[model samples]
Target: MLAALVLLLLTFALLLWPVAVTGGIASSLSYCLSALVPSLFPFMVLCGFAVESSAALWLSRPLGFCARYLFRLPDCCAAPVLMGLIGGYPAGARGTSLLLEKGRITEKEARRMLMFCVNPGLAFTVTYLGIGVFGSPALGLRLFLSVTLSAVVLGVLSGLFSPLPSPDKPGAERMESRPGALTRSVEGAARSVLLMCAFLLLFSGLSALLHEAGIFQGAVRLLSRLGVFTPNQWAAMLSFLLEVTGGTGDARALGIGPGFFAFGLAFGGVCVHLQVLAMFRKPPIRPPLFLLCRLAHGLLSAGAFALMGVISPMENASTAPVMAGIYRPELSGGWRGGASLALMCAAFLLMVPGETGKSSLRAPGPKLISVAGVKFPLQNR
Candidate 1:
């Protein structure tokens, strides 16, 4: 306890020092506030509720047989699997941990599912990469398909080949009975999101420290001397190695090819890996699995995109309009980003006691969100 308090004190001291003024801290804070806080918080809440409320277990019932045979996983894992595909990295980790806590799935199954479910979402692939970066929806779609296919291949192969291990704790295997399941789940999700934000900030500061120390510069100089890559390629590669999100942005700025962009996207860099590793703290899942799967996913995605480039050359999308000025209702307000954002915001706003904002949301038990003439109710049971 003393050590933990000391560590916390040291963390605050560093943030107070040169880190906050640096661009790294600024960028990380900007990302969390503008994008991650609003975007991820809602999904995190929903995911938490999904597992605690038996929503995942209820949904996975019908698909049990297929999931068992095809994926070599118990039907109970279907929730996390689906969440992982849609939610991306750490969603699977979140789900796995949840299921493990519930005793619905063993630690081995959860670990296997972790490798299986993690992937970038359609929004990141299509909206950010496709339209925002490459300026071509087609290129983004191609990258998305490639990454999905690669993840599927890995999951299937691992399912077939790997043998199961005993649960981490033999007796504590299903969800335990507890009061305030809804509140607990929501709080759990909130905690997870906050933790992720912390990791991002820490990584950003560390990256800035490394940069100021000339570590990245030295790496670029050494790599350049190898004569293996051009200046632009080296820049893109270096940025990609340092921070996944910023690296991809740099790679795109350098005019790196679609295949390489896909590679960086799939690789998700060390920043993302740290975010994921942070999620698995309670369960004691292996950290190395996340790293291994990412490398494999990156290689497979890059190869696929490269092959596609050779077969059907991407048109010069340089002239394509940037995504910022466009109205992409499909990408934004659609399932991937928009709807969930609304629901999450509603959940959060309505959570404040006696502050439902209006008479319509002032229900005693739960809240309801009406969209397109349909009512979706949020409740504990």
Candidate 2:
């Protein structure tokens, strides 16, 4: 808590320094709010509710079964891991935390789950990268396949390396059957979505403030000159470190051939890494393992993208304009930005409170359940 507080304070102090010294407070504030409000607001509201009630629930059972049988993880962790893949990092982390608190999963299992749980989804790939940024669904498809396949391979490998405790292990306990699976699932999903939305909004605002103050540009320039990256590559790198949306936007702005852009996008930016790190907090996972997994993913993604760049056929000229058109940002009149902010605020309010009133629903009433013909105590409501 203290560390988080200090970080927040430092962030604010940095943002305020320029305004305090130059007396550009109003302009800085305006730029910060405007830049953040449009993209961050609606995303919080729409994605927040949709992710919890719809995506998280839909994926949980299948994910649980896979984790239990394939990975040998405790039954409790399946839903969260699945949620992580479908709902993204925040959702996954939140789900893991909830499961941990409920005593459904041990710390070791939670940490292991975190290793493979931090990633965006196919929808994000198709919508944001393919249609929104790349202007070609085909490019998006290839990039999505590359990233997804890499994640799957890495996830499986990590699971193999980090073997779960066997049932005979000293601390191994039998799984409990929960009664309000439906309700708990809904509550858990909602909480996960709300938390993610909050992070997105807060970070988006921070990102906007930095961008408006020209800090982002300076950082990009510094990073670009440090290595083999070109100016545009530097931008993409910085954006990835800062935010996925920003990184993807930078990649689109490069105006490079689809092949180069695809590589950059696949390699991902720093922001994705940071988001993954942020998700680790809830599970209290070991930082080294998480970092190692990300490093592996990065290397693999870079390799895949590079190969695609070399072998993929050039996009047709006729499609270029269409792609460009899709990637172009529309300049919204002032009113639209304000409307977006309003919508975001509304969404935040709607999703943040749904968990407060719900009672802690216990698992199905205490009864021994058999797994692999071995019976164990069950804690039920």
Candidate 3:
């Protein structure tokens, strides 16, 4: 059934030479070149660097208390959760997988962490969703805050419920034995960011194709007739389900509501989930459970948005003004600059964990982050 539908859409697109297809391509390109590159690519690079830097190990040290007691996991688990929320998507997955590879977390613990650790980052939310798409920073902030709370609650619950890993399990190979890490991190960050950017472009194109195909319109019309929502509301909801970036854009166009936006964000689009699965290739993940969690999380976010809408006396979502933001390819230094400074500080702070005494200079040097005598390599394993 699905395949047939896809074939029909493709045939129609090819035969009709629809303008919506072109608009999708143009819109995606424009958004990527303008908003995504400036807002997200840098953050992606920063996340990559964070993964490779000794930051993870050092970060775990300071937050070990919370990890052991609050989250009920090893102290090393903190950074992954923190990184995942701040850096977005697979950063948390990557962090958890690294722990498994290192033998710091057992398979069980890693699976549990997977439940709550992953999410789109604050920067991604604020930059792209809040500023670029909605034109309302408040909307973006609400999405970010609501999602953050959900992840945190889920993470804590995951920690409390999941059993802790046994201390006796062997750790991954010692860090010193691995190749130079500094170079690897830089390369890894670049690779991850580029890969992510490619996916965004692909999905953007997909979203446009669907819109031009009339599926979205058809669904919205059908949905609108239900008498519960307007065509615009249905349009936004359907767009969100199909492609997050495209869906959010449609939601913005229709002025559905912030609840829809929050729901869309929590669902994180199929594009992001694919990204998560791609990143967690090794030791096959349990898809059913993950999908269930994603569904629950999205609904939870929607509820939060609705609750906020009720409590706040702000303008209705459809009526609120969207503050326009300009994006420049050049680095003239404003929020981007401040964000860079913050990223640097975070990376620096993450470096604080480990055996305190080895002060090795950056580049070609071995930056070892030792956790309880185990050296966390800077190299991408």
Candidate 4:
């Protein structure tokens, strides 16, 4: 009853402030076009391809040892970890869901993986936050490193403490490569990206309506009355909790610390959390566990970013090392070469445990691909 009342009130508010909602959506659309799509779409396609085409198994081989020793997981689990770290957000969620669907990973393992997976991509962190927000790619690089280190620590701790699962699960290591894998990957990625953008637009419009209704201002005033935070700080904090991209930008505009921005990136806001949850038919992890891990990740990233700032301050553009130069084609071999090197490093650090005793080269079963809520099997060629 209360939820329905809230919805009715929200609907009335939206009707009263359509212009604000439209403007916010337009801004979100511009952001998606210029930053979000460019940063995420290609990687989503590639990550999907890696998993669907059986490249994940082959590429993750090098990390098999680390996965076994550090994470106490199988070699196959490393693939989704890499995807989460590189492709970010729903990519990790999608990869984990796919693995669960295929029985490559157990539900418990998937829950454990969710503690550290579903991260913001390096491109979004370094390119958008670092260069665009702070005007220092080096700073963005530091923030990215901070976030990555925290996630790695979480994965290590989760692995070390959690009981190891049985190694020989049925249906594990039976993924088969099928024709049109690339096409399916591309199609799924497109659908996923579209869904993500839709969420962004929805949230953006809602945020604008709330702001227009003075809800945010009222909250800020309340916080100020309690002396919890300055109005600007409160506003930035609210933005960070609700939407990451806008929050980071607000943090910069409000003269909030880079650490705060790092926290936003790691926590990934409500917008990101919803996107991740939508990927699964049943969310593998509990809400309490998810919230706890998110808070832990946010704090850890902020602390790490603060430590980096003290050790090597990159606030000054003139003094900051040209870390973004590595992204330039002329200065570096190219993104492809850089990505290959990154994968090699990641493979060395991650792996999982399953399909024990199964021959690596055994003939596999048909692969299942899901797109737009429909599932079908692709026969192994």
Candidate 5:
């Protein structure tokens, strides 16, 4: 009743700020057009194709060892973990949901995996933050490594808390190919990208309304009075906390360091959180758990970034260069970026054992249908 009343009141207030709301929505749409659609859409399509084509299983073979031994998770988890690390944001969540939808994993496993499998993409962290924001690709690489470390730590810790069930054999013995996989992948990616944009626009408008109402300014003033940060710092932090994209310029502008940006990347802003939530029809993880994990991730990333800063100062760090073409800021957000990850996954695919060389291990769950040379899982009625 209270929540409903509050929402109703907020809705009433939003109607009063027509120009601000419209401007925010327009800016968000521009961002989607220039940044989100161009960078994320292609990567999402690739991720969807990887899962739908069952190439994920083959690609998971190398990471399977780490998933099983280090994380103490089922082998099927490697694919989603990879997706989260490489594809970024909701990609990992998307992969987990796919496995759940296919009945390859239980809801409990999906929930646990989601704790660490949602992350910022390497391109965004390295390219946008490193080069675009800081003018130092080395810093971006360090930030990416920091976020990855935190996720790895969380994955290991989650395993300790919620151990997998015994007799957890691999999800499938062989890849299940589908001729329609590409088309389905493209369609699914379209839906997911649209949903993400919807959430982004919604949050952008809400943030504008809040700004017009002086809510953010009031909070900043209150916090500044308590000496948490200066009014400017609080304002900048609040902006970055609510929406990472708009405020993710130079952290030094607000007298902050890379640590703040690192935290934002891991925490992923409220907008990114909503985008992730919208990916699932029914979210497997509770909101509290999701928030807790993100908080931990942010803290860990900040700490990692700080540690790296102390150990390797930026002046000295630039001497050690990353991949020339791949990590370059311009290429990292486009088709080449997605292609690089796909190629890497393909390279790993070579390590997987062929059908004749593999031992048969199966789990009972969904029925499979074979058409021509392709296999598809029958949807549950």
Candidate 6:
């Protein structure tokens, strides 16, 4: 009820604000809603449901195998990794929350999993942002490497700070298989995807209102004056805070240079983080640790961008050929090859489990309903 009231109040304010009305807020709001509700939201929900039901079980094994062998985390951690990689940020958080609810992962493990679980997919990062928006396939590769590396580093650091029990530990138990688990997984995925999409649309519209009111632009201007950021950097930061696509769009419009673009991509949009946190809230996951991870990501991405800037010429020249080499075949307006490759990679990741023999499983049951018609489920497995 509090959340609903807040949304109502926010919407009322946006509607009444003259500046928000004048700055194309209405149009942007319409566009955002249309994209999310009828298209993106449904797709995401269905995808989540499908993945959780069918793909998760198969994927958990390999993820469990990998995490146990490489990171020493139990099999439970694998679910979040799989969900995050396939379903995007919220999926990861939802998965983590589910694991926590089931007592599959300890609080410390949940915190650490939340830290590095939210990430955009390779297809979205590479195809949409890199090719569609930035017009540089090469930029996509660099951004991919940057974000992936950042996740790995942060994941490791998070583990270091709050280590999970070793496989040999007495409390560490292998995940057990259950009957009809696939169906339950699907339902949980569906619920999570729907909740996430609703919040995403709401926030996406709010972001549009802010943009129209010049609130976002003003914020960018203020940050740019801090001396460390270029106009592009400021725009990227604003977008990151406000919305990922918007920030990336702003960066593309600036056309500052490859260095700045790389920086923006690596940093991700602040709005993306907000959207991610919003999704996690639905599952009632802890937010502070996720925020910490975002902060760390921003810092690391900035440092990486700075380092790239120092050797800008060499990095640019060397990266060009590599980008060309990887994407050369797709230049003829064929996305199938790239799409296929991404699907294959996703499949491989989904299939692999961490070392823990236990499968990270979400229990099958109806979500609890309150007097206000709110249905609360424990977690997304």
Cα error, residue 370 of model 3, in Å, equals 60
Candidate 2 deviation (Cα RMSD): 18.8
lDDT of all predictions, in order shown? 0.67, 0.52, 0.64, 0.75, 0.73, 0.54
For residues 7-65, write the lDDT of model 4, one tens digit per residue: 99988998998887887789889888888888888878876776677676666667666
lDDT accuracy of residue 321 in candidate 2: 25
Model 3 spans with C-alpha error above 4 angstroms: 1-12, 45-53, 131-139, 165-179, 225-227, 309-312, 317-381
| Model 3 lDDT tens row, 1-381 | 999998896777756755545555666777667655565555454444444555555555576667777667876677676777777776777667666765667787777777776677788788667766666678788888788778777777777656654322223123412454556655655666566667776776666555445454566566766878665666667667666777665565545667777777777777777766666556445777887877777888877777777887556444233555444455459888788779979888665555765435333553332322333222110
- Point to the candidate with the largest lDDT: 4
The lowest-lDDT stretch of 10 consecutive residues in candidate 3 is: 372-381
Candidate 2, 166-188: lDDT as tens digits = 33232222223334455655554
TM of each candidate vs. truth: 0.72, 0.59, 0.72, 0.79, 0.77, 0.63
lDDT of 1 by residue, 298-362 (tens): 89888887787789887866622375755556667557677768887998777655644455555
Best by TM-score: 4
> Deviation in angstroms for 296 in model 3?
1.0
Residue 223 error for model 2, in Å? 3.1
Candidate 4: worst 10 consecutive residues by lDDT? 372-381
- In model 5, the clashing pairs are none
